[model samples]
Target: MKKAAIIGGGVIGGGWAARFLLNGWNVSVFDPDPEAERKIGEVLANARAALPALSDIPMPPEGELSFAQSLTEAVEGSDYIQESVSERLELKHRVFAQIQQSCPDTLIGSSTSGFKPSQLQEGAANPAMIFVAHPFNPVYLLPLAEVVPSAASDPEAIERAKEILREIGMFPLHVRKEIDAHIADRFLEAVWREALWLVKDGVATTEEIDEAIRMGFGLRWGQMGLFETYRVAGGEAGMKHFMAQFGPCLSWPWTKLMDVPEFNDELVDLIAGQSDAQSGHHTIRELERIRDGNLIGFLRALKERNWGAGKVLREHDERRRVAFHAAPASGAPLVMAEMQVLPGWIDYNGHMTESRYLFAASETSDAFLRLIGADMDYVAGGFSYYTAETHILHLGEAKLGHRLTGTLQVLAADDKRLHVFIRIQRGAEVVASVEQMLLHVDMQAGKTCPAASSVLDRLMPIAAAHAALPRPDGAGRAVGQRKS
Candidate 1:
């Protein structure tokens, strides 16, 4: 039940708030900006749907939020402190000074992209307590954070920061050496420099460059990094061949890296002006929504491939699995419990394919077994029931997220065999039904076995309850039904 205090409610801070709160960590936010609260609130509204929907793992109830009166009020007794104010050194140093006085031992981090931890800690009484935990734009979704521990900082600070990052589903990389722009942002800087050159020289409009990126390598870059893209270009020869073939291009005049672009108002206005022209169709908020949606889609597809960023997602999913408590099965006969359907369960045709019905029906059967004493642990003791065969009759199509419940009945059961009739319910109507024949097998001899004495005791009640319930709709007629 550790609490996290956020001192700035800007983009990064708002995302941090969403992440912590979603992971069941109490969050206290303090933002003096007149519009910070409103902006963060809008971000949280999108985050509420996006974050939980990101995983199949049943997340715990999100932690409550408290809008603090002041910075001190937010940090009091907070286990972790995140300072995401403006990127100016003076402003960050000021925040650090207050954080040092208020919570010395608590891990204080700056969400600055370029500033080193040492720079932020400059004017502080206890600068060693502060570090840099630079996160991406949508911190709530993307799970990568760069933890930069200053040379003046304690050795344990990086470890502590990493532990906190892990809890919020972020992979924390502790940079051994500090640099102006750390890791991911370096690539961004390179891209930005080239993009500016394109605009300043009038070779391509801002929208044209954006189109070139979005339609070209930007599409590939979503799932694969730059190195991987080049590796593919090298074909079967790999990086060595790629380097030999294309490394000479660095000397060519392809890029405008010879001269640095000064941060002059005219150039800024030109680029900003074109950007505004290109984006005049939509507001900043709408563009942000579009970007968030793209990020979600990109990251999710990456997770499927289990690539660079997706690997972190896979681990986070594993941790979420360990932390999540699955809903217990309802033992009441013929009751449809959890009928949730994931996107993967549906076919490209937008309906629950026949094979998935078997899988879901099987899961529903598992639920019934769990309710009784014939649970997973019980079956894992070299005595699991094998589904000998299944006969399914799919009456209606089941789309993604369509509530499909199973009303199961022990049509017949004895020591060696189990005959189950499961009706798939969506609201009041029965959408599908299945008859599953399972055999209780002893793995030692690969032969059927009588139910264990302990299992028998639990089975009697379940069988009795299921027997008492009326047969479900779509029950197969005994006369016309095949031997199965």
Candidate 2:
């Protein structure tokens, strides 16, 4: 197992810990604050509830998490180290000094929002190993990580750093030239400055400003981003028309980009009071859950379309799927799919709904079909397996966030027909089981047909292997049948 050292346990550090741990990296955290454990525990709880829902395939087994007493203990022998201490340059340098004392060659990533890579590498024993890996808030959910490297930094180490970030499901934006506040934050600061001016001038309340973004351009930005959204606004003429139409407005007095509101008490109270009036009823954690739920919905919609950040999520799922299927089939039932009970999968009774149980079974069976070369490519060639009948038994409850394993056992198989038993399990317990009969069909003819040789060649062996196993009790049972 790979090891990661998190040299802080505040919000970002805890998020880093959660992301690495969920991706199956053993993480050791070092934070001097007394409440770090409690704080990180809460973050982990929230991460556990949200992260798995973003994935269609099962996640890797969670890695072990440990809290180290000293920074040296945490960094020792770690493959990667992320420092998320307070945004004080001196404190970061101190932390870096201590970290290098133990593992000088290990890559040390700083969660600094404003510091350039050169700034971070100052006074370092091994400057090449240190770089800016700034992540947005809720590092476990958002995928973007600004990976800034200086001229002094090693190219090989930077590339390796990016791969590590990708392994934990992050999109590493390599900033070729480092600048103050990096990329996303600079845009955010502009919007924030304008938002502050709006409130100060009594133009809009906090709730109104939030509604403007969440209900308007925020949606566009989430999908197509800034330039593409404007390109669409350009219509047939594209970016040229867009610039010709709005280029002169750059000199207009619409935004106070170069100006700043005085950071005085009155301004703080105005924003804080409006924010409190807007959302003070819910705690911070409650707000985080609400935000995460909304993000999941938006991201899942994008994933369905394979656009924007959703594309990153889909690619990560595909990577995991490849790894999950890498092992050769054992003699037992093939574990075809791994999934989690997402928030939407549950009903009012707080258990996984009936339709989702079938969905899970379909996911499992679809995986098995793909294993036998009857995937989308095969279907696109005017042939595919169509489910003819299905029977599902609800053996137990699967609640939200429960990890599920879908296993398939071939009961029978022939050129044109397949009979299979599938189990949806939560750990060792079978929460549900599905028995299905499928027929291979030629799509153009609308009639059952024999499967292609390539598919049957793979399927027949698995069928022969499973034929020796005892028949599942749930198989061949009619509805309302008594247990025998």
Candidate 3:
């Protein structure tokens, strides 16, 4: 297992820890704060409830998480290190010094939103390994990580860093040139300044400003982003037309873009008072959960269309699926799919819904079919396995957040027919079992036909191996039959 060291355990640090841990990387966190463990634990809880829902395939088994007593202890033998300490440059430089003392060559990433890569590299023993990997809040859910490397940085190391970020389900935006606050935050600082000015001028309340964004342009920005959204706004004329129409507004003083509001207590009280009235009912953790859920919904919608960040998610799932199948099969029944009972998979009584059990079985069988070369590509070629009959028996209960595994045992196989038994289990106890009979069919002819030799070559061996094992107890059970 790959190991990562997190230098701080604040919100962003905890988030980075959760992201790495969930992606199957062992993480060591070193934070001087007394409550860091509790805080990070809470963050991990929220991540457990939220992150798996965004994935269709099962996530890798969570990696080992450890709290280190010292910075050197955390960085030792770590494959990656992320520093999310206070934004003070001296503090960051000191942290880097301490980190280099232990793991001098490990890629060190600073979660500094405003500092340029060059600024971070100053006074470093090895500057090239230290780059900015600024991530948004709730890092486990948000995929964007701005990777800013300076001219002195090693190009190969930066590429490796981006690959590591991608392996953990992040979109590493390589900012070719490092600037203050990187890319996203620069736009954010502009909007933030405008919002502060609006509040200071008494033009809009906090709630109204939030509504304007979330109800309007915020939704647009979530998917298409600024340029693409405006390009669409340009209609047939495109971005050039958009510039011709709205470009003149750049000169017009419609609002204050370059003005600084007084940083007095009065302005602070005004913004704080309105924000309290807006959403102060929920605690910070509660607000985080709400934000995460909303993001998941928006992202899932995009995923269904395979557009925007959803494409990233889909690609991540496909990568995991490929890795999951690449393992060599053994003589035992194949472990086909690993899944978690997501929030949507539960019903009123808190048990996994009936449909999901079948869905789980399908996930298992589909994987097995893919293993035997009957995947979507093969189906597109006008020949595929079609389930002729299925008998399901629910033996136990699976609840929300429960991890389930789908294992398949092939009972019989021929050129045109396959008989199999699948068990969906929560660890050792089987919660459900499905027995299916499938026939190879030619899609154009819509009739049963022999499977390809390539597929049969893969299937028959597994079938023969499984045939040597004892038949499952419920292999041929009839529906509603009395226990005998």
The candidate maximizing lDDT is 2
> Model 2 compared with the native: what TM-score?
0.94
- Which prediction has the highest TM-score against the true structure? 2
For model 1, residues 339-388, the per-residue Cα lDDT tens digits are: 45556678889887778788768767775565454655776787777789
Q: Local error of candidate 1 at 311, Å?
A: 1.8
lDDT of the candidates, in the order given: 0.78, 0.92, 0.91
lDDT of 2 by residue, 68-134 (tens): 9998888888999999999999999999988888898999999999999899889999999999999
The window of 10 residues in a row where model 3 has the poorest summed lDDT is 322-331
How much does candidate 1 score in TM-score?
Answer: 0.74
Candidate 2's displacement at residue 347, Å, is: 4.2
For residue 114, what is the lDDT in candidate 3?
A: 97
Q: Write the per-residue lDDT of candidate 3 for residues 81-132, one digit (tens) a residue.
A: 9999999999999999889887779999999999998998998999989999
Instruction: Give the poorly placed runs of model 1, Cα more than 4 Å off.
Output: 262-265, 325-484
Look at candidate 1 and tell me the lDDT of residue 484: 47
